[model samples]
Target: MFGFSIQKLLFTVAVIAAVWYGFKWVGRMKKVREREARERLRRQAGNGGGGGTGESGESGAGGSVSGVAEEMVECPACGAFVAATGAKSCGKEECPFLG
Candidate 1:
């Protein structure tokens, strides 16, 4: 009877340990996913801001302007040339840019 009780206790301990380890593993995975998500967001933010400089003196410092004539696109509403990636209406209330 004592040996049977010992076996039951061991089985209970094993099951508890397995559950604890599973929880720990899940928590660790969640932390890793959160860290990876944060890294992706940081990379996206950096890319969105357009970092670095060109071979010439231009550092691409202008807001929303790529400074490259080839990359510029004309806005149909206001006929204003803006960065192709950022081309939009002139943002004038009287212009179609507002919509």
Candidate 2:
């Protein structure tokens, strides 16, 4: 009787392992589908001319240098933002944003 019970226990263990592996496979498939859907959406929006990154305008009295990032520095004196390369803290010594 004990030997018969042991055989049945072994069969149950095998069945449980198979079910766990099957569920794991299904989860992986679902994740792949979600990733593809997001990529497609990104591509469609990009082709529709929704935005421009890495873009700059010609430099004049008030223009960003061509092909250069417009860097702005925050003033610690008055909280005003200014261009990093040519910015002074408003020359206001009393300003909290002074830096």
Candidate 3:
């Protein structure tokens, strides 16, 4: 014969709560990942569709197209990577990118 006790009831409630919270956490994480993936795809699409040219048949340098991944170079002075296109001085005397 099974007899229900207060301890058993409390334990069951705790287990249910744990499972509910776990499910909610998983769902929230899944939604966050999905949203991030969508954002990445949107950025990629907006970035000239991976082509260096835009609808006007001009290169990305013309400013007509954007989202192109630029080459990054390490700053000799700061050792931090920066966009190579318009690299600027890091205010260090030895910075090679200094203009």
Candidate 4:
């Protein structure tokens, strides 16, 4: 027979653990949200008006680099973005990225 005392002890431990984890999780999430909000507010204030910064600044602007991003290909069967070199032609089915 399962004793009530043992069951009660386990239940108490479970409840305490649940409450502790919930609090920690919520606190972490709150910090993340606050940080994001502050960054957004700062960016908005700096740019003036409520609108976000117009066009993000690229790190290597106008710097000529032979990168893979420059090479792009459009599937003939489906208008999905794919790499130019080794992309298989979608003959029958539409590409997942497009859908």
Candidate 5:
């Protein structure tokens, strides 16, 4: 025979509540992380767009910042891919764009 006791019912309810709240907490944390990432990206873009004294030590005409995607071009002679904005020489005689 199956017995349905008040303690069993209460324990089941507590477990359900704990799981529900745990999922909610996890969701909240994920949202917070995503918001922080977006804010960080926004700040980087704002600071990177303004031409400064190059304190970050990033070498480029535009002072390119990390995490930003750049257009790539394939080298005709070496068959290597390089950034289109500041393509460097592949050290080959036929390579275009001076090193």
Candidate 6:
């Protein structure tokens, strides 16, 4: 009878552990879903409610018909491509795009 009681106690403990871990897993999944939703909302907000086109004067995968694409200049300091719209530098204080 004592051995049987020990078995029942262990089973109850195992079930409690399972429930705790299950709740933790569910909480992690909920956090991941919330983060993804927030990321999507931030991206949509940054798009400025445009028709997903070049209406905002930004170049995209599809060619823009409203305006000519601004030429991308190679930053001599960092060798990074940046727009040539009065950009004296690539916004990097350490390495300004002099060239």
C-alpha lDDT score of every prediction, in listed order: 0.69, 0.70, 0.79, 0.70, 0.81, 0.74
* Candidate scoring better on lDDT of 3 and 6: 3
Q: Can you write out model 3's per-residue Cα lDDT over 1-99, one digit (the tens) per residue?
A: 145687788899999999999999999999999999997886776665456654432244655443456888999789989999998889888899866
Please give the distance, in angstroms, between residue 17's alpha carbon in candidate 4 and its true position after superposition.
0.3
Which candidate leads the pack in lDDT? 5
Candidate 4: tens digits of C-alpha lDDT, residues 1-99? 369889999999999999999999999999999999998886665564334536443455896654224477776667766776667656556553322
Compared with the true structure, the alpha-carbon lDDT of candidate 5 equals 0.81
lDDT of 1 by residue, 1-99 (tens): 999999999999999999999999999999999999997785565564464652333354764643333476666657787766645567775554433
Better of 4 and 5 by TM-score: 5
Model 1 C-alpha lDDT versus the unseen true structure: 0.69
Estimate, for each residue in 1-87, the C-alpha lDDT of model 6 and write its tens digit: 999999999999999999999999999999999999997885776675456564443345586443444677877767887788766
Model 4 bad stretches (over 4 Å)? 49-99
**Error at 61, model 2, angstroms:** 32
- In the range 1-99, model 2's lDDT, one tens digit per residue, is 999999999999999999999999999999999999987785664454435663222225575444334588777767888877756667778654434
Models 1 onward score TM values of: 0.50, 0.46, 0.45, 0.46, 0.50, 0.48
For candidate 6, give the lDDT: 0.74
Over the full model, what C-alpha lDDT does candidate 4 score relative to the true structure?
0.70
What TM-score does candidate 3 reach? 0.45
For model 3, the superposed segments whose C-alpha errors exceed 4 Å read 1-4, 49-99
Q: Which stretches of model 1 miss by more than 4 angstroms?
A: 53-99
Q: What is the alpha-carbon lDDT for the whole of candidate 2?
A: 0.70
Give lDDT: candidate 2, residue 11.
92
Angstrom error of the Cα, residue 27, model 5: value is 2.4
lDDT of 5 at 52: 56
